[model samples]
Target: MLDDTLKSQLKAYLEKVTQPFEIVASLDDGAKSQELHGLLTDIASLSDKISLNLYGQDSRRPSFALNRPDQDMGIVFAGIPMGHEFTSLVLALLQVGGHPPKVTDEVIEQIKGLDDALHFETYYSLSCQNCPDVVQALNLMAVLNPNVSHVAIDGALFQDEVEERQVMSVPSIYLNGQLFDQGRMSLEQILAKVDTGAARREAAKLNDKPSFDVLVVGGGPAGASAAIYAARKGIRTGVAAERFGGQVMDTMAIENFISVPHTEGPKMAAALEEHVKEYEVDIMNLQRAVKLVPATQPGGEHEVQLESGASLKSKTLILATGARWREMNVPGEADYRNKGVAYCPHCDGPLFKGKRVAVIGGGNSGVEAAIDLAGIVGRVTLIEFMDEMRADAVLQKKLKSLPNVDIILGARTTEVNGDGTRVNGLTFEERASGEIKRLDLEGIFVQIGLIPNTEWLRGSLVEMSERGEIITDAHGTTSVPGIFAAGDVTTVPYKQIIIAMGEGSKAALGAFDHLIRS
Candidate 1:
């Protein structure tokens, strides 16, 4: 299944294996099984430390386990780990073969100390950009802790399990036999959930941090840029974020970043974090900022409070909290979220295969989602609130050419209909005819847009727009002195990743200029 070039690359990577491991497969005589057999054969041929075996006794057919010859490590791939999961497979091999993982010693120790007999099964899609992180993290944990076992399953290939579990989303994790979490999660986040005392320990550590000269409140492109710029000035810089990468982590394809022709969200986010780490920035990921307290006296530090009960003070604070996916407030929308309502087409599109689904909104995201869904789903109904689609001409043309797609303009989504468990259909009002219509579908994909993450600033000293966006001047400085805002969280017109980064850098410069003047 791999080309000659890929073979050469795999051989180079496999040479780093310091110990011997076996790829034991229990594949039946199916198409995917044969394909997986070929992939394993190619991989095993590249490394003398690697050995391949078939016809194992695993209950899940077309699956394999990576383990030492003497022991079962309990790290299993229940489906063919290709596409986005190919990287997970490679990492599993390297780690199982005794190559050290690229994780902090502290985190590695935490994983080793876990004594719970936890078994994790994650349902994932091949096209999902968010699944690899969850799969690889669990794989590493299983490799580290003998009490932990993880099974990475491809949802599309295992339709029976997907349907039985009602998994409408990718990266749906189950602990033991119950649902644990859905969507993207970091290794730290997973550890926090499993390790009970991890949160209190993290909070205590965060609370002990000293005051920073320039403090950034987000970890998106803008926040990363700001942190880097501030740290370069030989100042103490710190970044506290709900999760590094912000909304950019949910993004699939980013083509218009200038010079970089193609990149995924996770890859770009990783690069941003790596760049910031090159400086003296102290990054605190998975930290949510809930309140902002302005400095009472001039030339004093402002305080930013986190949901974890940790507070950070800074001379100048840069707010780059960015935005989140806007949701329809209609009835049943919230109730059915992840039950049948989804946001990313690339992540959840596979579960809706051979079923009817609807895409809400007619902007670029909505149109692109419809076009992508048309290939996998049985039918796609695109509904828009405006009379005309806001998508570009090229996308509109492609969407119109798809035979399995239908577009409805001037329609407002009224209510989402579901049978208490999952979405069944939706009701919309036609603007032109004043007629209420219902779409009978299995899923609804919301692709309207984003809303700034500045609700915590309300009633505070910070000036805000009617849309709840933080108001900022040309310098990225907010209404309050010594408090600057940038990225989508501010009053910036465009919300592109590149624009956010530039604005972040500008905000850092503005903060520095203010510090010098003070």
Candidate 2:
């Protein structure tokens, strides 16, 4: 049963649904099925426009019997939808109940015009904040086109299929039996994959030789800021990235972006892209920088080779490649990722509000996460593998002041224990006594360290720190004259969004200075 606040909100939303829609539950007499039935019944009770139907496996209708033979429009709930996925279920109902898809008109027209049969199978976990975006997008796509059909499967309920497909993360999408994408993706990205044949041919025939005055290697917050600043100078600027938004996309809520009180990662990422598009900056998405060849002469252009058999040349370069979170490589850790194990505390902390959680590592990041989560969650357990905590004295003092926080030192995480659905507990061993203990927790945040995305820069002239971070000066200038580094990938003292944006601006100004002097 939902709380009064949530039920009120859902009832209000359902009341606005004008069209009639049916939610079908395909299950036998099982506890999971019974729970799902109850949830659907409650949802259906909100409005007369919504109806709930139940069918056993033997009586289930074939996919071909639906509106479109090639597609199945029957919305089925195979298991209980809780956590973030509850939003997916509600949104699906609203979308199917006559709410228009929140996409561009051209995109809608393109989807409507498609005649080929397209089916999508998306696997998601209830706790994964990012999974709902992909699930909702695919569901909306199905609603928009008769030729397109989609099934949103809870990964925990379908562990066999997950293991068969080797899915280690949430929002693992498969199109027509082939893996399309494994993480959060926009609707346009999914459409591109649907037209894979045409896209491949187009990519092969693309022969345009691109050149720029200043080229940014990454499309994260830092790189986006650099490109925006450089483009404001009216110079040819280009930004290439594996994806825009970088680590920000994985983050949930961002409150420290300066001036803005609170914002989500995906929202901020979209804003960054929208702001960048306002300028004349050339954006290349889904492109990875493979190699960097520095210029031979002072004013000569440097070449950036890409993994996609494309190249871009520029007089100055800004390496804004971002960093990723370090993982805890223990049993069930990868399997339960997004299910219960998470990395970005800011993004996922609110999801675990009033629940018991744990923080791995006793470093500053771990301590900070514990402090932040203690206010929201009921209880927080801080575990350190070392004999003592490595966080600062001030942070330690603050942590000690928190009554809800429990600290355990010299504790090594042995394994993450969970049902096939979500994490319930974890096993840890004390170093001194070799005694094993278990803590029943709803979620675990791993914040040991960060690894810079600078592996491709190996053997290059750019100097790197012992930890592989790109060494940069106060002005964001690297060892090479025309090259500059910024953001978490560089030797910056902090890795905040505001700090990265400032560094990006500094790097862009530095590049402009070098370009004019040359």
Candidate 3:
């Protein structure tokens, strides 16, 4: 299963294992089971502390569990962890073998202190860029607490389970036989959900923090850049965000991030955070900003309030809050979201494999999603309200070459129709005529655009565009003297990662200039 170079790396990683463990696999007489056996054998060959047991009593075939020799607590992977989850496999091996996780010690202690037993099952797709994080986090939790157990299942490989559970999206998690969540979630986010008092504790901690010279709201590319620039000026810099990566974390392939030929969103987001950490920026993740109060006078402190009932004051405030996927807002769309209506084709495309699906929009994202889904789903229907596709000419040409794809222009999506549990089809209206049509499909992918994260700043003194995006001058300075805005949350012409970073840097400089003059 693993190549020669991969084997060398695995051997080196296994060398760090200080404890003995076993790979207990439950298999049947099938091709997939044979492949899994070969993989386990290859991994067991890397270190003397690791042993492989091919026979097990578990009913789930092609599944393996990693456990310590002295402990009954272990984590299970029901499907082969390849592609994006290969990192997860490596981390499980090391973590279950008594190696420390990359999370903070406080979080580690919190996981270990949990007394309630949790049986978690995660259904994920190999192509999903967001699945590895959730899977790995749960695996680490299982390693930390014996009361916590998790099984990571591949949705594509286990079609029966996916259908029985009505899973229409990747990274669907079930806890104690009930649906816990769907979509990407961090360790802290999961903990906050499970631990009832975590929010109050976090709020108390945040409330005790001192004021900062430059405080950045949001933690996307722009926020990271602004925080770094501010910290470099020997000013106290802090960053509060709902989650450090913003919408970029949900993005798939990013090809235009200069210098680097190609990269994924999660990888780039991690790199951005790491680069910012090289400075003196104090990052507070999982904190959502709900309100922003402008400074009373020049060089005075502005307050940013969080949803956790905590607020922080800053001398100069930089609002780099990014945007989110624009929803259709049609009837039943919200009710069926994650049940069948998904925004990320890269994450949820595999769930609709061998089934019909529709992509709503004519822009580059929509065309690209159709192109990617053509190879996975049985049929791809691209519905657009416009007369022509807004995608690049090259993308449109390539989309036209796909045999499984059907393009319908001048059609607007109307409603998402679903059976009680999952979506079955949707209705659309013809632009030229008053006729309404329906598409019999299992999934709908929305790729229209984004809505800025500036709704929280409504009625504030800051200038803003009609779209709710903060308006700023060339210096990235908002109408308010001590307040600046950048990134997708602002009225920037181009909403790209590089552009956001440049704007953030400019805003930091502008804030400093104002600070000195005041």
The best candidate by lDDT is: 1
- The residue pairs in collision within model 3 are none
Backbone steric clashes in candidate 3, count? 0
Candidate 1: residue pairs that collide? none
- For candidate 1, what is the TM-score? 0.99
Listed in order, each prediction's TM-score against the native is 0.99, 0.72, 0.99
lDDT of each: 0.94, 0.80, 0.92
lDDT of 3 at 455: 83
List the candidate numbers ranked by lDDT, top first. 1, 3, 2
Best by TM-score: 1
The superposed Cα distance between candidate 1 and the true structure at residue 503, in angstroms, equals: 0.4
Per-residue lDDT of candidate 2, residues 347-422 (tens digit): 4665566779999989988998899889878999999999999999999999999999999999999999999878
Q: What C-alpha root-mean-square deviation, in Å, does candidate 1 show against the real structure?
A: 0.8
Q: How accurate is candidate 2 locally (lDDT)?
A: 0.80
Which digits, one per residue and each the tens of the lDDT, describe model 3 over residues 1-518? 88999999999999988899999999998999999999999999999999998877777888999978868665999989998999999999998787888888899999998899999999999999999999999998999999999999999889999989999888999999999999999999999999999999999999999999899999999998999899999999999989998888998999998998899999999999999989988899999999888888766889999999999999999999999999999988989999899999999999998899999998999999999999999999999989999999999999999999999999988899998777889999998996999989889999999999988888778888888899899999999988999999988897899999999999999989888888
On residues 167-205, what C-alpha lDDT tens digit does candidate 1 reach at each position? 999899999999999999999999999999988899899
Native-to-model Cα distance after best TM-score fit, residue 57 in candidate 1, in Å: 1.2
Better lDDT candidate (1, 3): 1
For model 2, what is the error of residue 233's alpha carbon versus the real structure, in angstroms, after optimal superposition? Answer: 1.9
